[model samples]
Target: MDLFTESGILLLPRDTFLTDTHVQLLQKQRIWEVEVQQVLSEGTTENITNQLMDLDADKETVAAYVKALDKTRSLFDGIGRDDKPGLEQFSDVFYEVAEQSMKQLGLFRSLYVLEGSDSYTYRHSLNVGILCSLIARLLKWGEERIAFMGLAGFLHDLGKMRISKEVLLKPGRLTEEEFDQMKQHTVYGYEMIKQMEGGSELLALCALHHHERLDGSGYPHQLKGDEVPVECQVLAIADMFDAICSDRVYKDRTSPFEAAQLLWKEACNGKLNIEFVSHFVRYIALLYVGARAVLNSGEEVEVILIHQDEPMRPLVRRSGEFVDLRHERTLNIEKMIG
Candidate 1:
């Protein structure tokens, strides 16, 4: 059977039989019921109760996010297609968006819970930009630097426009040659941004090197350690986190808490900046305290405490007992119900 959220958004479309994984995906996203009909309507639902939470985003924030995504999609499609898109027009909307969001509390909350998961390219670009701005604010960067990071993130993937739609949107794994070709998006982005009227070298560099790793394991250049610019390193973390946490064609979306754990692991492995990842992980844990979540064993839990040393493994309360995830290494906050 097919399933959809109350918003009438497609969840699992008309499957002959739902597998365990499919059921798990729905549960993980906290989706409960779906409508079925011989002729599915573009019509609306009555008094639908959204299963998502206030922590995800307030109405205004969600509306703004939707507008930003639409704008990003428009700009991405228009830019370089005949010079109809002005570089500053993109930043005019983008930088203002990042700056305006600075006034909100839980600035990262909306970033953690965007809908329309299939709109990865458009949504991911905007989310990475929003994440970059949030990180800059957390780091106490100057306004100019914060805006610059947002702009860098907003246009980071513009080079993907040069790729063929088939290879870019393939539902399966790409062959090695195709993968190599895919990596060229970084260079393509760098070159594209460099020639744009209003972009700077720093912006272009962020596009080029956001994929580079701290331990020299990244693509485009094997630049290691201090060689990688801090901007690029920060962007790299943001990009990777969004990619992991957000739904993609081949995978279901992982919860923000689980995504934090993966980020922490990479930091420990030296693939990411420890300072950035550690701070982000701690903040994420603290932000999700009192959140409702589902453990992998299909048990519901409430996060009660964030362990300073192991932020990824927060203590949770379930069935009147407090369970320390740090001790129960196998148990995880698989999905945040909010």
Candidate 2:
């Protein structure tokens, strides 16, 4: 049967195949006693029942996420208009979502898996915010600093609102002129934030320098090493990770493992902070320890363990056998299926 939240948002369509992950997500949303077709064989029913046992659930988290997305959409829609949203407006909504996201990693993980393809900007903003906060927590920062990091990440792309949709949404290689205009988003965001109430120089600078790299290879001011603030450094990692893992007009989404590898590569090339990349990439790799993935060789496997030295190349289980990616260097995880 079809499932809808109390707020009337469709949660799942009728007859959707319920994987173990799906069931766990529903349980997290406090959804129990779902009506399903009685077509499962006796053995399948027993297996599902066993998997459903001892699950924890919470409804508010999912509801808060939906409301946060709606709020984000509304705020983005008002950009470039007379009633553009202020820093306070964005913070108010962001805190609500951040509170829910911090409750558990599962909610944050589910967001990536269940996200729709539309509204890329709004979704990207929210996801980056959550990721920034997560990275801050992983760094053992104080609560206030973590909150600031999230806000910084959330507003880092505000300048994109000023770009012409024709250029922003173009699906092919951009003309040199178009690319130059696109790069101005940092400047635009900086100006916009500077004008907003409660927006500080640091906040505006985050929007300005988030694209800046350590190797003097970044734009708006090719700042190298310490020229970029530590805050902007963190924002750069979160921003790049999300962009690579997310679908864009011109490219398909890469898997998180692959994205982590790329981040590590960039760090090694002096474009990103190697220490920060090491910490964040290890966490990202560990997050998918139990996930299902398709390897480059077309074999489906379940990640069984993450090697600390090579988190991206984990030990995986395939067809009742184990494949140690560390030794099987020819094969790599192509993408996650769930």
Candidate 3:
């Protein structure tokens, strides 16, 4: 039998036999009961029964995420058809998810683990929006600013709707010409936002400059350092984190641990906001403290502690033995297996 949270997150696929660890996870989440199918007589009858189980207790959060993703897909489809969806429409889609993000910190932080069949653009938009809001709160921003930041992140990639399907969905490397066209999404998003009712200059600029980096390597205008608005700086960090950590058409997803390392490196190289990266990456590393991961050396390890000095390199337990990643520089987490 298949198992899923009330919010539609798949916990166990059909025919998956539950293990003790699975039950423990479910119990930890407060999921006490689930419906399962029992087969009898080799095809004569299938019986459905309520069985004991347990898991994370964020059905509301996961459900809100699933609903927001659906709405995002519809909104993006409208944009593709040249239909201008207003700020109110985007807000309606984001508020529920944003509210959930504030309450269930555990399940909300692991939302990416519930990836479904939704297209990349729609899912990325929603994830980036949630992440941007989280980062804003981490900065101790007020409620009003946090809400606006979430909206800005939701609309950051609106320009991609204008790109042709062939260029957007190419399963392989893009040619130089195609890549140039792709970069125009920032400009297109800026223009689209400017035309929307109630869209402010900051919102429009966020669409335009979210890709702009501190080192002048970004596209659209190459704005650097203070030239890029602080709001856009926050948006850029969320955008890059989601893009790197989530699966895309041409690339597999990298684990959040490795993704944080890359973001930290970019910050140190003057390409990203160092302060933002530092706070965000440390939070990300700490979020998975008890999560399991596979190392480059093929051993599975459970994260035990996050170092304050180097959040990306934490202490982990492998086969009941502790290994400090800071001392073992050559070994890094390759993927998250949980």
Question: Candidate 2 residues 141-161, lDDT tens each?
Answer: 999999999999888998988
The digit string of per-residue lDDT tens for model 3 on 1-338 reads 66777688887787554546788978876789867554211110001000000225366676666677767776887787778888899999998888886787765345444332236787778878888998999999999999999999999999998888788877799999999999999999999999998888899999999989999999889998999899999999999988887666677777788889999899999989999999999998998889888899999999999999989999999998999999999999877756
Candidate 1, residue 116: lDDT: 35
lDDT at residue 66 of model 3 (Cα atoms) = 64
In model 3, pairs of residues that clash are: 26-54, 26-55, 27-54, 29-55, 29-56
TM-score-based ranking, best first?
3, 2, 1
* Number of clashes found in candidate 2: 0
Expressed as tens digits, the lDDT of each residue in 159-208 for candidate 1 is: 88777666677778998988888999999999888888887888998989
Error of 2 at 48 (Å): 27
| Residue clash pairs of candidate 2 | none
Q: Residue 190 lDDT in model 3?
A: 93
Clashes of each: 0, 0, 5
Local distance difference test, each candidate? 0.75, 0.81, 0.81
All candidates: TM-score: 0.80, 0.81, 0.81
Q: lDDT of model 1 at residue 126?
A: 79
